[model samples]
Target chain A: AQSVAQPEDQVNVAEGNPLTVKCTYSVSGNPYLFWYVQYPNRGLQFLLKYITGDNLVKGSYGFEAEFNKSQTSFHLKKPSALVSDSALYFCAVRDMAGTGRRALTFGSGTRLQVQP
Target chain B: GAGVSQTPSNKVTEKGKYVELRCDPISGHTALYWYRQSLGQGPEFLIYFQGTGAADDSGLPNDRFFAVRPEGSVSTLKIQRTERGDSAVYLCASSPDPAPNEQFFGPGTRLTVL
Candidate 1:
């Protein structure tokens, strides 16, 4: 089984400032991590995923995440936040070896508030 | 490319009524999944279909929920005797035939039970 945890319920950041959304995971095997963003009345949009690559993975809308093996964390980060970027963010994970098993487990979600 | 499409963007019905939500996966995609999203929560997996068969339904709350993916393209989720707790947005997503691929999501059908 695999599970994800978004430690913060909400994160506030000023426009043009850097921001970070924390995410941690627990899985029976090696983890495949993903990040998704949801706008109001919209579906979850794929941001990025960490399968087998570098620790810092860049994604759409200038977002990136660091996959830390030791800490078991895959935190989303941005150099300069945008007010339009305010939305709900989710972190998900699946086991690498759960081939026939479901490959996605999402966190509770973290609300990102970018103020001007 | 056309993303996944779902029908009945919004549905409202009284308790004990039955509802069906539809989904059309991206063209040629072989993996379809159904997920339910409650208020202030992330989407929870309901079922997964590989081709025309249901490969997983572990997340389904009970026997009242059923889904089908005949012909391996379009899928429908049927809920019977709906309760107030069944009200939520149902999302459908599809990916390629293999694992570790990104899943495209539909706009989702908001089912509200009164």
Candidate 2:
């Protein structure tokens, strides 16, 4: 079984300030982690994924996430926040090595509010 | 060059009625997936289709929920006896192949049972 945990229900960041949204994952084998953003009345858009090789992965919309193997954490980061970035963010994980080629397990998501 | 697409952007139905949601995956993507999203929650895996066959249906909640992709390009999810609990946004996604499961999502159909 694989699971993901996003501790915060909401995160507030000011425009032009750096932002960080936390995520942690649990999996039996190796973990394939991903981040997505959802605007109002819209489907989720893939932001970034960490499969292998690099601990730090950059994604779309000027967003990036760091995969910390030791702590089992993959935190999404942005060098500077923008007002348009306000949306719901989700963290997902899957067991890439599992036999099932299982579906991604998503966290309860965190709403980000970027104040201008 | 189009992304995944789903039909019936919004469906309002009475309880006990049957409703169907449709999805058209991107051209050439071999793997398609169906997921359900409730208010204030992330999408929940419902089914997975590889080619023309249903690769996995473990996430389907009950027998009333059925999905098919006979032609391998389009899929339909049918719900029998619509209930208030079944009201949610049904999302469809597709991926290329093999290792990367990076699914491209459709706008989804919001189903409401009255």
For B20-67, candidate 2 gives per-residue lDDT tens digits of: 999999999888999999998889999989888988899999999999
- Provide fnat values for all models in the order shown: 0.68, 0.63
Q: Where does model 1 exceed 4 Å of error?
A: none
lDDT for each residue of candidate 2 in A2-111, tens digit (9 for 90 to 100): 88899999999999999999999988888999999999988889999999998999999899999998899999999999999999999998887747446778999999
Interface Cα RMSD of candidate 2: 1.3
Best by lDDT: 1
CA lDDT of every candidate: 0.93, 0.92
Model 2 has a DockQ score of 0.72
RMSD of each: 1.0, 1.0
**Ten-residue region with minimum lDDT total, candidate 1 chain A:** A94-103
Poorest lDDT segment (10 consecutive residues) of candidate 1 chain B: B96-105
